[model samples]
Target: MVNLMRYRAEAVYREVSDAGPGSGVTGREADERYSPIDILHDIGASVVFMGDVAEQLLGDSPVWDRVGVVRYPTRRSFIEMQQREDFREKHLHKEAGMAETIVAGCLPIDPPAGHLGEVAWDDVEYPPSDGDGPLMVIHVLRFAEGDAEADMAAYQTAAFAVASAHGARISGWFGVEGTIIGDGRRWDQVRFNLFPSRAAFMSVLADPSRLEAQRAHREVSIADTYTLLVRPAVDSLAASIQSA
Candidate 1:
């Protein structure tokens, strides 16, 4: 069996109403109980990306508050962490804070080369017209029950060119393995992409050439998929944590 690294991407929707600071116990309080960074670090897990969900592009899915991707050194490391008592204790906070969530595990396969370092949000360029903030798109996909390999190849060849033309860069890509936690949702692949703005992204989607290319590969290869637009929450989170 081929040993592959594991990654989990979570879509988190936090409780809407905030409980008072003095509230003995509440979902908000649970969320504030502890940060999982230290534990994740001790267990050799790295956060690939973490941010606030900015927009919903597909169905009328409930709004998500945050989206994050975590990388584990090994699949065993992931399993071991979950089995640890301390880890379980900390997880209560996550559950308390979350109104709804989806977590999916994936195997890193042919992730874009050279984009694997700690991301520098400052270096990310944004269109002058888009005053909202830097935007990122997360794609969750499942392949059809056919020649998945060939379908992927055909889709990628056409998609890459269109992506580049629209000034979108792929930050991360992985093949879905199975669920490690949360709802038992399955996927075949997941991708993170950065775009200048929503308009820029729409341009890519509306491109005649790109649409034409999709018919030849993407349409046939993908059985189901969903995408989310998000804003980087790392910088703000880091600032708050440091100040605290």
Candidate 2:
């Protein structure tokens, strides 16, 4: 809960600035956008907001390009929020403005511990902790041929703990229910972790603890793992939004 609050405040502070593509939205304009989101803070507000606003502003309707996530304090709170008129009307409209969106519910994993080494979290003029690509550890996991529910629950339990301990700042995680594009298969679990640096990431991979955990997890958790070395670049037109 403490971590959630800290991150929320951080997001609000960081978000309420020239973070978006500069279409001339001054400070005052940004404040207006954040007003509604801020009021919902204490009502179990741990969410991950992501998308390519640039693409959005261009009027492209590419699917999965924009999203707003709201995390409730409990399942009950989530249910209540979904039922609330304000939540339904305002939230849905805000989302509809986007080109594409998907909403999901999930519980957090445990602390990630096994890692390679520590990187200077402050070295970069701008840290890619949340925006994109510090190092994305993508896992291709699948449940049993029939017992999908039981398999997913077990994977989440172990993944959360291990990820948190490894100093992985989880942006968010989700489970896919329907068929994925290109394949008729369904992905049971998806997790995203942003490491401080390449060395920091390697540390976890080489850790004895991580190795042991990997061995245990391989038994029932993962079908395959693909590492995408992504480095999200600040678009050429977005040069004015420089980091302080």
Candidate 3:
């Protein structure tokens, strides 16, 4: 079945620059050597979203710099690519550039239509003052023990209500299966939310109604969570990557 792979990478570029070095390969050169997107395109995998972290809303010291999601035609395609000798060779560059990373294979689940109907891009309210572009928040969650399904449902009901009221848009949601690569941290679900701006997101946090609604569900249902705010890189680089 079609599946999505989510990757969070913490790159260490101390030894690497945007430009390549002369003789010996540097970290930047190693990153250049990794061109899995081309191979992924050939294997019918499509980029979903790729962006860099702009802020950390709720989490320990931030370690990840970039996060990306790619959809593969089938789980087998991903496995087959990994089994290829050439693919293994290309992975060396990835290892060189990345200090830490996590790759999770997830299955998409279609929840009932959320209370907050889809908000059009134009309809989203911008900050009254200077601010960055649209903000995307990544939520990595682990549900409490016993009947994870029930916990998920409870959390979603309250979260959707609060999110809808706050004008937050759900960009992506998935149930994480397990780690496919990198650090073996386990997560139950992954969600992406788009806010009009940083101001809007902050407003959401301060909304008393939202807080009251979310308190009970969040506390009882979640065991652990991580939230990262990211600026969607909509430049040519992101476009090219998506098209690849």
Candidate 4:
């Protein structure tokens, strides 16, 4: 799941749960206390990545505080976990800490190798080191009707030329399965882009090739999108989610 969180300024403990501090605790801290490692292990799931939002590079969605991706062995395991008393008990911490969240089921895939000529989208065979220090740009997308792939292919062909100039690459590209939690907005895909650094990402702001592609192809293909820049805390998604 791709989790975009907006934390409450102060944690609000529900009446039924008395597990966390009632005062002077930030929502993020309270959420940290909500970890259910054992419950996850029982279902053969794991958190593949977690990061704080560095900035909102594109789109008009509400600013997010943190982003995380969790993997489940199966969707049924997730539902079953929710029904467990222990899981429900721990969920209170997340409830108290979060003011809003967008939880989208994300399935990782190799980026369309055809469009990206030399950009490294091959995490399945060779995953990059976190030490490469790329900024993770999360793209949440909703495609428009008919022949979206052709337009996207054209867009990627142009956009990636500019992207390659900045030493950028694809970390992971996901097809959004469904929304687990959100404001009922439908999404098509979520793409993870990795730029060498914040400066490198910013430098491509006015690249003519990218702008032309955006104008000619990308803009017309997607009805909605959000491009987020995140600073990763931990990331094993590239290696783990390919099989997941």
Local distance difference test values of all predictions, in order: 0.61, 0.40, 0.64, 0.79
* Winner on lDDT (3 vs 4): 4
Mind giving the per-residue lDDT tens digits that candidate 4 earns over 128-182? 4455455788898999998788998899888777777666767788888899999
**Model 1: CA > 4 A from native:** 1-21, 24-29, 32-34, 59-63, 111-133, 235-244
Q: Which ten residues in a row have the lowest lDDT in candidate 3?
A: 1-10
Alpha-carbon shift of residue 3 in model 4 (angstroms):
0.8
Of models 2 and 4, which has the larger lDDT?
4
lDDT of 3 by residue, 77-175 (tens): 989999877788777667666655668888775555776536554555553234556787888888888765665566667666656754677666678
Per-residue CA lDDT of candidate 1, range 1-244, in tens?
A: 0111111132132343433354446444455464588888998775656766667675355456567766677778987888988887777567656665667776655554332223343443435254744567777777788787687676666666666655566665677677555445567787777776776677667878778877877778777676788776642322222332
State residue 152's C-alpha deviation in candidate 1, in Å: 4.3
Residue 188, candidate 1: how far off, in angstroms? 1.0
Ordered list by lDDT, greatest first: 4, 3, 1, 2
- Clashing pairs in model 4, backbone N/Cα/C closer than 3 A: none
What global local distance difference test value does model 1 have? 0.61
**What TM-score fits each model?**
0.71, 0.41, 0.76, 0.87
Give lDDT: candidate 1, residue 32. Answer: 49
Instruction: Give lDDT: candidate 3, residue 24.
Output: 52
Deviation of model 1 at 237, angstroms: 16
Ranking by TM-score: 4, 3, 1, 2
Question: RMSD in angstroms, candidate 4?
Answer: 4.2
